[model samples]
Target: MVVIDINKKYPEIWEFLAEVPDPEIPIINLVELGVVRNVEKEGDKVIVTITPTYTGCPAKKLFEDLIREKLIEKGFEDVQIDTTLSPAWNTDWLSEATKAKMMADGISPPTDDNKVVTCPNCKSTNTKIISKFGSTPCQSFHSCNDCLEPFNYFKCHR
Candidate 1:
């Protein structure tokens, strides 16, 4: 049996894992989605701690497969992904940088204060909510009067 050194292997795992993008939004990786919580190693097996974005998020299975595949690609024969729901998933887990990227990508980011969403195309504060549901359950549809562009607003996750 070969012994694995976690300190040296974990960074490689992180780098390789970064390649796994979110299925819903391919622009953002799972790490940025706050799905990957921690990475640990015991003996020759690697353990990845993950938190699903939602209770019934379908992407969770894809994420698990991606992690396993990436680790295997990196030559780690044994890999285990552990899902944890404790502490739960909240919008607070989203990084400010990620939010900015979302806005730049024409998707309004979620605000902590539940403020009205601004138009991503025109940067206008004068936007009207069109529908409570957007392209996804986590977003709302809005139309901007300034640019006449309809955009999706990331709903404030509570």
Candidate 2:
């Protein structure tokens, strides 16, 4: 939470990053997706620290490029990106609001215990895991028994 709070310390920088959407999930911005870890301002330079959802995340380079581009587009010439794995990233970083937004978009967000991943299509708890891997590495495929709809569940990572 302390790292997230650093984002608030620089509202403008955070806002700039917020405009940069996730490369895969374009519906959600990087900030809301919990990819952006910290933001700091030093003189004429802006430092942004980000943590990948997972170490092997393929979108790592794209995330940095998008962030740098967005900041530069906002008139920031010196934008430094720092990748940190100190505390690491976890599903707990996602907020309730962000989860709701994901759910509304037909993607089940991760849960605390991950015991139940409701179907976003029908809001049914009667679901079963279809595959350990979904269309993406961070998600798992699932099917809703009631609605008979296939969906992806954002896997719980800690």
Candidate 3:
């Protein structure tokens, strides 16, 4: 049997969670995605609260499994992962660092205006949307005249 002190264990838990990446955007970890809302420990059980990026996002199931696996690997046998949709998700939840990372990765970060997306490749404010849908549902495909590079724009959320 493994014993863990909740207060003493959070640092390790945070570090472990940092390893779980957003399945769709592997470049960004789920923690950076702002999906992990809270973590608590009740005796031997570890409770994790997650806010989904979208209501019907396909990655939800995968994220649950990944979280469970990660906790188990970290010596937490009784893990309870609770997903909450109440507050819903907004692109605003993304950290500035995460946004910058996305831009650096050639994936256009979300804009303050849901409709107008910037070009990641050239950092051009002048861009046109090719399609509302990009490689993923959460993103839109766009091309920049300045750089002429096609990139995926993170769709602005409500």
Indicate which candidate wins on lDDT: 2
Instruction: Identify the runs in model 3 with alpha carbons over 4 angstroms from their true place.
Output: 1-9
Which one wins by lDDT: 2 or 3? 2
Residue by residue across 1-158, what tens digits does model 2's lDDT show? 33345428888788888899888878789998887878888999999998888888999999999999999999999999999986778777788898998899888999866799899998999999999998877899999999999999999887
lDDT per residue as tens, model 3, 34-138:
778778899999999888887778898999999999989889999999988766677877778999999998898887776667788767878888898877768
Q: How accurate is candidate 1 locally (lDDT)?
A: 0.81
How much lDDT does each candidate structure score?
A: 0.81, 0.87, 0.82
Q: Per-residue lDDT of 1-158 in model 1, one digit per residue for the tens?
A: 11222243467777777788877777777777777878888999999988887787777888899889888988899999999986677777677898888898889888765587889998898998999987776778999988899999888886
Worst 10 residues of 3 by lDDT: 1-10
lDDT of model 1 at position 64: 94
Off by over 4 Å in 2: 1-4
TM-score (C-alpha, index-matched) for candidate 2: 0.94
Give the number of colliding residue pairs in candidate 1.
0
